[model samples]
Target chain A: MSLGEFDLIARHFTRPARRSPLGVGDDCALIAPAPGMQLAVSSDMLVEGRHFLSTVAPERLGHKALAVNLSDLAACGAKPLAYTLALALPRADDTFLAGLARGLHALADRHDLDLVGGDTTAGPLNLCLTIFGEVPTGAALLRSGARPGDELWVSHPLGEDEPGWLGDARLALEVFRGTPGLRVPGEAFDHLRLAMECPEPRVALGLALRGVASSAIDVSDGLLGDLQHVLRRSGPDGRPLGVVLDADALPRSPLMRAQTAALQHECLLAGGDDYELLFTAAPADHGAVRAAGQRSATGVRCIGRITAESGTTVHDRHGHRVATPWASFDHFRS
Target chain B: MSLGEFDLIARHFTRPARRSPLGVGDDCALIAPAPGMQLAVSSDMLVEGRHFLSTVAPERLGHKALAVNLSDLAACGAKPLAYTLALALPRADDTFLAGLARGLHALADRHDLDLVGGDTTAGPLNLCLTIFGEVPTGAALLRSGARPGDELWVSHPLGEDEPGWLGDARLALEVFRGTPGLRVPGEAFDHLRLAMECPEPRVALGLALRGVASSAIDVSDGLLGDLQHVLRRSGPDGRPLGVVLDADALPRSPLMRAQTAALQHECLLAGGDDYELLFTAAPADHGAVRAAGQRSATGVRCIGRITAESGTTVHDRHGHRVATPWASFDHFRS
Candidate 1:
């Protein structure tokens, strides 16, 4: 016997919130936004195996789902208010669901976001969370507001690290087969193994960029790939736009650089799953922007500039043109 | 090759909303509520083969997801404002996503809900939508405010045709056996068939019930089952509650009565998925309440009264006590 849907919701999901005038078990949760404030809303989904390893802890999965949605609101400079979670679990497990809810509530409580209303059902392991916040009108950042003269920037270091991890596959497979004493390079593990597992979402940096940055987007795709989105959107009504990247300005560890050179450096330019913020700000506001960057303890790099050239172009240290391949993830590539 | 997640979203969901200052493709969407108002938020999820038949059109699935969430806001007397959708599709089919987006947009436009930020992912079929609205503070209804003397009422009639349509165990096996020329009664078939498909969310009726109705909950589960939720919440300092139903006052069509009788008369009391509004109103507002109900054209029926007793008790036509099964799609019971 398993816990039914209604009981699961009652026991695990629908707990009364401290600040909520009306919380779970109601038709809708009611909140009074500060007068003269506008609400910001965003939704995101996390699918098992697609978004996370099946071996990942259920509690971590719940936390990530809510964390990612909250990060979206943070990117708009909105203070989180409430959220509703729609969970599709394979079956009813009281222990797993309780732990998941606990993790969700822990993060939500820290941010003052009340758990409002949502649905729970039996299905594959999928989590979709919709969150709400309030920001003063006309202040939230948008991706279409970047001007041609704006300086393109990123809140965290850009560049991918996949090829370095898969180095000498033949030798490594043979070593694992029988040679227990084979030594693996520590630098290789950091560039490859760590990068693939947990990608930190830059919540504080995104919120800090709101006032100064003219436009922004979360970097789920690679830097060059995602910037293409901002450039295309910020252009004059869907026209192509040019963005020039200073290859040297991209932050890279010594180990990463060596690994990239050995691997033809293509992976560094195109690998995905880095959940940082790519944005643009006015040249005059660069000092304040740089000051805000120090507060987050993450280096803000001026990587490029929005230009009217109508397409992306990368440059080497000598200012010569560099060829860049499509560096975004293709879900269905043979 | 199938379109990747980002491309799929760009192709089908990134349309410019007429009222949204910034729509999809943003970190977060801004919604400006009318001055001097509070915000209301609600969410719902629809999974294939569970909430609906596998054959239901994708377009209808999109509409129903938003509609159901909007109905929640309506129940709180909140006017529609904006919504964010999170959709997971098994494959990247442009036409299917387009039809689904069109359906969502059509209903949203009618209700003045601006499409805002959303995420698209590749996974099992599930659509989770969160809708936001604004209403006057202190006017939203809650389920904890019902008094013992308050009259229990429901919008529209009871008795869905799901049981008759799903057929008895014998009939279900017959259908699987390919019984040639076997026929279910047409009226029963129509009722249950309708039950198996679309459900009309009573948005307007719910909004009208606010202020007058002390407490409310949507009739997602059957009438008696949902009423138990109200009773559990409205009791004194966390005490169990009792409710008494007036059999004669339960509104149902003649066909519904026959259908229920055919299934041991439980369908009227235990059938779920009827998206009606179950509420409790003060006796003082009876006249105006009835007038409002007439205006909505959904018809309001006063069926019972909340009591301080510990458990539920139903009376038959001759006042005999009858045992009622407490199970209706119990999520814990597989």
Candidate 2:
């Protein structure tokens, strides 16, 4: 069916704003934040090829688009309220749009988030979602609040070994699935693939960790790179603090184990597209952190500690260096 | 300087979040709106080639990217609070970044809007801005509040004749100026070109008319197409409100006189990208509307009325038929 811009929005994007004062069709969405609450806002843009493979399922793309922004809110320990989409598409293909809308609605509905307002324009496929959330005033976990000696906890393990955590690897599956008569362990990669493509945002976990975790950041640009933000912001005594990741303590992924240790370390340390939450908490609050994890129904594991020293490193339990760390993914690394 | 994604954001996008509780470095920005207010949010995306030409200045491109979103806030009578920019660039070119940042900051500073948070990544240049504003709960101007007896008021006159209102004409100047050494009325087109390129959102005017106007929307799409939204939403009883446009009353521009009458009308009624405000008010509130225009220092014109009848029509002052209108600007209209 042919759809005009208005009809496209009405049919695929518009939803009654049950939680907001006004929604979809208006000039602006009216959101009434509860008293004593602060609004948490963040935006993420996913471009075709750069962000995902062209053959990836549209539903998964939609889920990941919103999921990435929600991950930001989660890192701040905010409860999702609503979100707006700014979509630029090459064309309005009905099947693609249907799958995309279904994926977005499935996740958004699960979080009770209203699709507020957005713009749809003609261009190469670029999807940007700006999500709105709320947290108790002054209670958001920021990257600046960690101190030296704080326990660094990850909401889950990182890398491809853990199919549950490899949402981005789903694209790899899509690429390899189309390989010319290629033979590979398909079933082994299935879970990891889906995990990479549709990684769940740790919203509930983030909310539960509030007032518990001293600082937090979502792992978008690999673990080490993202943690650098926390270290930079929460440096001890005006000095940039380094992080110490114990090689053995690192989350073990079966897919990662299949690779050489160096590659595994690289993937775990600097491979981005991981939506897991890496946070800090006082050693004394370990029990509380575990409890919060249970309450939120998400896993939590102590992976390392924030150090007073500058720079980041990976070491065995006995303190032998496994490898040197380099800069994580940079848009303009050169 | 060879910049990384982090440096690009730090150098160009990063600024102290004076108004926001938390800003750029965090997962999400935290904003505390004043009590008794609702947050009004909108997002817009501009893509190169689709939204602008390769010759367009990066400064102007950046300005329009934010300007379009701000126009939506004005239509809702919301006070600018903050905005998040999700920028995707093919490469990190320093000069382009500088110009874009300068343009964004200039307008943002004027509006007192803080660049609270955003994501910067590598891709073909696509800029998405999501603006946040505040209005007293229940006091927001909506497209659905116009009554049959309401007098239709536009923030300015419509059509190509009105250079004061043709923001899209800014590109036309660029077209003719770049015409392989062809000469045209350069100075005569300056004001119109700049006006179209950098539209001043009717923020003050919309705010002034908040309690005064019954229904409102910013004319991003052409006049007729946008008014259709009002008519659809604010109809009387069960029928859509009919709108009558007086051809003679449309604000005129000298540049428009160069175009044929049909082209002039087409540009006036269906040309998109005019960032003026279109609103309706009770006949008794005419004085308030006049006050708003004076306060905002922008032209105000009474061009029509909302009727109990259905559909829209354009006619001359003597009731002679002018033309029929269709959909405004659809991404997939073709």
Candidate 3:
């Protein structure tokens, strides 16, 4: 059926808002934070071809669009509230809109996020979501809170597990690209595809680490590259901090371990779209950090520690400094 | 100098937050409404060649992008707070970025709206702005509050003033398209271009309209079409409302009056991009409404009245029914 923009919104995106005072129909949605709480806001824009493959399904695209934005809120240790989605599509295709709305609302229902207010128009495919969440006053996590003596931890393992692990997306991309000398079993490839298409935001872990972790950031741009952001922002007294990551301590799955060393390093160190939480905590709070991960049902791995040195470095298993040249994905540069 | 995505943001969009607890550098920007206030949120997306012409300058494009979003807050009578900008560009062109930033910041500074957290990436040119504003609980205007016998009003004259007229954008587009038999003065065309590119949001007028206007909506998608939205939403008891608009009462500029009757009717009724406020108020509050217009230094004209009948119609100066087949601009249906 041919639907106008308003009709499409009514049929798909509109729903009764449980928390917000107003939802999709009004000129603007009204929301208020509860007493003694602050609203955390973030906006993410995803573009076709650059952020996702054209071969990706609409349902997966809708999930990933909201997932990446929620990851930002997770980094700040905020509880999801409501989100507004501004979408641009070349045309109003019924099947695509249905799948997209289904996927988006499924995740929203899981998090109890209300679809508030936004605009839809005809254009090249793009999705921009601005999410709002809440955190108690003076309790949000930040990247600048890391200290020199703190221990660096990650919410999930670097390369293990089929459900929530890094590097699977990169492996999936390589497989899609038909890279030479690479082979994977059919079941394993399906798992990798799922990992690439749908990423779980670590909201519960972030909420658990609110007071436990000193600093936090999500791994969107590769692990080492995201580490640099924390280091640059974490200086306590005007002196930038450093990191000495134990390369050998990085975890790997059976499939990842079977890959060539170069591929493994590239996927583990420089792969993007992981959505895992990389955080820091005081050495004395290491047990608390581990407990937080356990409470959230996510694994925690400590692969490095904050340092007073001015630059980040990695050491191999033989205790030698590794010469690394892999850079993180920069939208413009890449 | 060629700048990376991070550097580009730091140079152009990053600024000190005056009211927000945190700004651009953080994972999420934190904002809280004052006690007894609710946050008003709205998102608008603009894509090149659809929402705007390719011939438009970057500065004008930036200004219009925020202006359209601010207009939503105006319709809600919400005070501007801050906004997040998610931008996707084909490339990081320095000149374009500089011009766009300058224009965006200029309007933002005027409204004291903070530039909070947002994402920038590479893709087809698209701008999505999610604006946040504040209104005391139960004081915000809504489209569902109008009653029969309320007088319908507009913030500015329908078509007279060159600065904020309704049909100037349409006239400008026609001029650009080189429509045959159309002739506009050089100075008048320049003014029309300004009207089309840099719309002034009716923030002050809307703020003054609180409690005076029973229902309000911005005139973006043509006059008759937008009025239908109010009619559909304003009925107190689920029975729709109607409007009786006087055709002769619709004001026109000297240049507009010179146009053919068909072009004039289309431009004045179905023309889009006019950011003027269309509102309704009780007949007993007509004086108050006029006073608000005076206080805000904006012109308000009463051109219609709400009716209990369920369909909208227009009448000429002689009271003859005028058939209006013109439809508002719809992104999908053209």
Candidate 4:
């Protein structure tokens, strides 16, 4: 059924806010951070074709929209609280709205996040979600806290895999684009599609790493590119820090390893939309890191160490310097 | 000059946040409410063609974008704090970015609002801003608090006017659309354009009315339509509250009064984007309300009163019921 803007919001977006004093109906949503807690806010906008394929299911699009924003919170080690979604649609279709709401609310319920307030209008399809979370004062993870001696860690394996295994979202995009001579097994195809459309933000792992990890960031715009942000931000005084990422030490699934060396390198280093936490901690906290990983039920792998140098360098299994060429996804660039 | 996505953000949107612990270039921006305060949050999205004409200046577009979001905060009697802006641009034009940033920052600086965090991407031109403000615990004005016998008020006079006088934004829209037989004086055209593009949010007025006003809302939607929101929400038990708005008391300018009766009715009653505070207060608080208006340097006019009835009705100067044929602007319906 066709619905007016207000009816659409009342039917699909409005929910009783448990943590907020008010939600959905008012001009502004009221929220107060718990005593001694700070609110962590992040915003992300996704446009059709630019961020997701039009062929992607509306349910998965909803999931990914919130997933990407939650990933930002996960990077900061903040607990999900509430979010405002501003959506622009070409037309308000009943089936699309239902599936989108179902997917959005499902993930929100899992994290106890309330859909607090937002704006809806008719325009080109765009989804902008601004999320709010909370963390104890002075305890939030930041990109600039990693020191020179900290060891780099990733929360998950970083490549294509079988149906039940974690893989890269870029694989799905490549398949959708019909990349030349790229034939994937049916099971692997399913795994890659899941990776692209339904990434799981590592919120639990982020929380677990709060005290143990020196600093953290989520892997979105490729590992190397995002890692550069942390490295650049964490620079000490005038001397910038660097990393010695061992190419072989970068975790990859067996299916990914079976691919050509170039494809493997591209997927492992430059694949975007992983939503895994890449973090750093001192060598002394190795046991604590492992314990935290176990507590959160997430895998942790050390691939490098923060160094006193000023640029990132990758070394292969044979201790040979690798030629790195793939750059991370930039919205304005091809 | 060509800019990548990150460069565009760093150049145009990045600023040192005054109140926030963290700002742009982080996974999340951190903010905390002061003791005994609650955070008020609101979001608004603007799209090209639908929200504004392509001929509108980019600077004014930026101002209007943030103005609408701040109007939400004002309606809730919240003090502005900071905001996140998520923008989708068709291209990274240096001139456009500079103008947009200038206009955005000008309003932000005037309000003492920090540019906390946001997202930017390449897509159809769209702007979404999520703003944060603070109010004393339990003192926020709500749409549901207007009681029967309270007087309905508006912050400013409605309808169009000549140059140097307040006017309705809809007049500018009508002029842009080239409506038949509509001739606006050149000087009046300038004022109407300003009314449409650079709406000033009544933040000071809202702050002054915190304790005096029972309920408040901004006139983004038409007066009659938005009043219905307050009336419906303020229902006592199962019965809804209503308003007896005097059409003649709507406070039209001389230019507006010269218009045809039908045109006057449309502009004063159903024109959107006025961004004026429409509020209610008890008859006992009349003196206090006047003091608030004086304190904030805003015009406050009483145009109607709340009643125990179930729906709104309009009365002309002769005390005869008038047919209200105009509906407010609904995004999906029209």
- Give the Cα lDDT of each candidate: 0.67, 0.79, 0.84, 0.84
Candidate 3 clashing pairs? none
lDDT of 4 by residue, A199-234 (tens): 889888989998999999998877887888888788
Q: What is the C-alpha lDDT profile of model 2 across A180-274, one tens digit per residue?
A: 43222567666666666887899999999999999999988777767777887787555677788887677655555565566566667766788
Q: Each candidate: how many clashes?
A: 7, 18, 0, 0
What is the per-residue lDDT of model 4 for residues B54-92, given as tens digits with 9 covering 90 to 100? 887888988999999999999999999999999999888
lDDT of 1 by residue, B263-309 (tens): 43354566566666778888887876787687665678887787777
**Cα TM-score per model:** 0.86, 0.92, 0.95, 0.95
Ranked by TM-score, top first: 3, 4, 2, 1
Q: List the candidate 1 regions with Cα displacement exceeding 4 Å.
A: A1-19, A157-197, A262-268, A327-334, B1-15, B157-184, B187-192, B260-264, B327-334
Write down the lDDT that model 2 would get: 0.79
Can you rank all candidates by DockQ, best first?
A: 4, 3, 2, 1
Q: lDDT tens digits, residues A1-334, model 3?
A: 1236567766788788999988888789999999899999999999988889888898999899999989999999999999999999888887888889988989888898999978888888999999999999999999888888899887664335655467767888899989987657777887778767899999999999999999998988788877777877787665668888877677656777778877877887778788889999999999999889888888888888899876777887788886567653232221
Runs in model 4 lying further than 4 Å from the true structure: A1-5, A157-167, A328-334, B1-3, B157-167, B328-334
DockQ for candidate 2: 0.59
Best candidate per DockQ, number? 4
lDDT of 1 by residue, A68-106 (tens): 777677667778888888888888877788878887887
